[model samples]
Target: MKEKIEQALFEVRPYIEYYEELKKRVEEIASTTDEEGLFIKLLEEEIKKSEEPFKTDLRIFLQKFTSFL
Candidate 1:
């Protein structure tokens, strides 16, 4: 689970670093909500703009992370 979560974060790292809006959203979510719910909501929003592999990866990460929550 830790590995999966790490991979998910690894995958999104570049995007979050490149996009100020995405970074802000992540920071806001982190500040306002729990980790599992935060990632789920953020991934749901990001999935719309994401392509293959990462989109699927985020969904899987959300599913796995939700189980821990």
Candidate 2:
């Protein structure tokens, strides 16, 4: 499970590094809550507002991550 989550994070790392809002939200989630579900939900919401390739990448990431749950 840890490995799967890590893999999901790895897939999303570039986007998080590229987007200020995403990076900030991830950091905020990390600091405020240990709930992975909330983190995934927030990411899904953010992805809905994103454009093309990035949105697709994030959706894939979410699908992979949620599969573990």
Candidate 3:
């Protein structure tokens, strides 16, 4: 699972700082918890709050995480 997260990080390397911190938090959260739905809900809320490029990036990141599940 760690490896998958690392791979997902690589897959989205070009994204901005917002996602960088979010990704790190995700890694931490994932390692410590099994609450997948919570992450999805969080991401959905973020996606709703975000503007264009970040919104698209978040969607893509969310899609990648969902694929991991």
Candidate 4:
């Protein structure tokens, strides 16, 4: 399972990096009151995109990801 996880991570590295970048951008937008709605929209879109692969156990994935950070 560990090896399979590693392989999956290798394949998804680009997506991870992209998501990280988007997260950073979202943080920036979050700081501005004028674009609060846009920030939420962007966050929703990002979550929606991530939900496909993460449908099996969304809460578990979030917990692990938060711990890693």
Candidate 5:
């Protein structure tokens, strides 16, 4: 399970970087839009979507560690 998680991280690392860049770009693009509320909402949605998987992985890791203890 640990190895599987690591392998998954290796596969997802690039996407994480991609999403970071995308999040930055979204913020920059949103800054230029007149509908600031909509822009902020979309930006947050993009970030939340990208972050959920990572958060899940962290929660799984914490559970694994707690079980080991």
Candidate 6:
């Protein structure tokens, strides 16, 4: 999973400059066992609450980034 995220990050990071937090979150996801998937749930909730452009960007980033997952 970590390897997949690294690869996806390589492909997608350049397209999204505002991805530092997401990268950090990926690190969090990589280092620990989030059995309940609260990490992802939080992200989904955030996306739902986010305003335009940021929200769409996050959604698109998640979409492309999670394609490997």
TM-score of each: 0.45, 0.60, 0.63, 0.29, 0.31, 0.56
Model 6 residue 8 distance off true place after TM-score fit, in angstroms = 1.1
As for TM-score, the candidate ahead, 3 or 6, is: 3
Q: Could you tell me how far off, in angstroms, the CA of residue 33 lies in candidate 5 after the best superposition?
A: 4.5
Kindly report which residue pairs in candidate 5 clash with one another.
Answer: none
Residue 64 CA error for candidate 4 (Å)? 18
lDDT of 1 by residue, 15-53 (tens): 442344444444554555555655577768876777775
After superposing candidate 1 on the true structure, give the runs of residues whose Cα lies further than 4 Å from its correct spot.
1-36
Q: Considering TM-score, where higher is better, how would the candidates rank from best to worst?
A: 3, 2, 6, 1, 5, 4
- The CA lDDT at 9 in model 2 is 67
Candidate 6 TM-score, true structure as reference: 0.56
Q: List the residue pairs that clash in candidate 1.
A: none
Candidate 3, 1-69: lDDT as tens digits: 566666776777776446776676556556654577875776687789878876877777778877888
List per-prediction Cα lDDT, in the order shown.
Answer: 0.55, 0.65, 0.70, 0.42, 0.45, 0.64
The parts of candidate 5 lying over 4 Å away from their true place are 1-24, 27-33, 52-69
Off by over 4 Å in 6: 32-42, 49-54
Q: Pick the candidate with the highest TM-score.
A: 3
**RMSD for each of the candidates:** 6.1, 4.1, 3.2, 10.6, 13.0, 3.2
Clashes of each: 0, 0, 0, 0, 0, 0
Query: The CA-based lDDT of model 2 is what?
Result: 0.65
Highest lDDT, which number?
3
Candidates ranked by lDDT:
3, 2, 6, 1, 5, 4
lDDT of 4 by residue, 29-66 (tens): 44553443454454455566654444323333333333
Residues 14-44 of candidate 6: C-alpha lDDT, one tens digit per residue: 7664677667755665566543355456657
